[model samples]
Target: MITQVQVKGLMFDPYNNAYIVILRDDEQSEMLPIWVGKSEASSISLALENVAPPRPMTHDFMKSYLDAFDAKVISVVITDLNENTYFAKIHLTYVDSEYTVDARPSDAIALALRSHAPIFASESVIRKQSSEELDQWLENLKPEDFGKLDS
Candidate 1:
């Protein structure tokens, strides 16, 4: 089973020296935190802020390629978590056919945001992320800890 989710916010993990993109369900109840590199976080943050760079970024280029081919991003699904890594798929429709492309969760999410595609996460992935360490980290987050896009 998969549950639809949205990009809730972006935060910094000082300990890991990485940025985290938080995906939240409609009720804002369930959340999945995926740690990503600074560059990836910047790409996603720009999309979330609706800011278009003077030059197209990698994700923008991908979207443009799909647009040129008249393809549409149907959705992006966070499908699995293994070895402390998360996996995702980008579902697309083109020329009356559909295709699923394997992608990193961060990249898939950035494209989804740019393409106006919905995001989802498999139940098993969610369950796998429900670790006590994650719980503690989440509980420790303050309101100001999020939206650290520029930093």
Candidate 2:
């Protein structure tokens, strides 16, 4: 079983090149945070803020590929977490054929946002990785905390 989840927030850890991304369950009862690379973080942030850069970013290019082929993203699934690593897949329907491709959760999410696709997590992964409740103070987090994440 899979549960639908949505991007809740993006947090930055300045000490490392790591950016933390939060995912909220459909019921808003849980949050799953995953560490991602700086560039990926910036990409997700751009979509969330609806910021259009002067040029297309990598994820934007991916959306263009989808548009050109008439392929639509059905959903993105965060499927596994092992030894501090996360795994994900993008589900697409192209010309009546369905395809699932391996992707990092951050990249999957960035593309999902571009495609208006719903995000999901495998029930087992959610049960293993999500916090019972989201951090109450996350709303106060500022983009400045993200540092030079676009790099």
Candidate 3:
């Protein structure tokens, strides 16, 4: 089973040289972190800050393209964790056909937020990582948490 979540915040992971996507569920008081690339982090930050890009970024273009086809991103599922890697799928619905696309958790999450789609994580992944780890990681972050990524 997959549990729906929300992006609680974004933080840098010095060990991985990448960003961490934080997902939270207040009802259950749980949190999960998935490491993501710099580019994907930038895309998510831009959307969170409501920054208007001079040109449509890849994710924006994707949203527009999907909209044109009347396709809606239903949800994003972080389905697996293997050898320290996280996997995800974007569930899309278009007319009569439902499409599932394999994607990195980072990219899937950024697009999901833009498309107003709920984020999900497989029970296995959550069990492997544990919410306590997330709590500790979040507690250690400071105000100057995520610095700007170099373009």
Evaluated with TM-score, which candidate comes out highest? 1
Backbone-clash count (model 2): 0
Arranged by TM-score, best first? 1, 2, 3
Candidate 2's C-alpha runs over 4 A off are: 132-151
Q: How much RMSD separates candidate 3 from the native structure? A: 5.0
TM-score of 2: 0.85
Q: Whole-model lDDT for model 2 versus the true structure?
A: 0.84
**CA lDDT of every candidate:** 0.87, 0.84, 0.81
List the candidate numbers ranked by lDDT, top first: 1, 2, 3
TM-score of each: 0.87, 0.85, 0.83
Candidate 2's displacement at residue 43, Å, is: 0.3
Whole-structure CA lDDT of model 3: 0.81
> For model 3, which pairs clash?
none
Tens digit of per-residue lDDT, candidate 3, span 88-139: 9999999999999999888788889898898998888888778887677567
Candidate 1 lDDT, 19-38, residue by residue in tens: 88988888877778897888
lDDT of 2 by residue, 14-56 (tens): 6565788888887987778877898899999999999998999
Q: Candidate 1, clashing residue pairs?
A: none
Lowest lDDT 10-residue stretch of candidate 1? 142-151
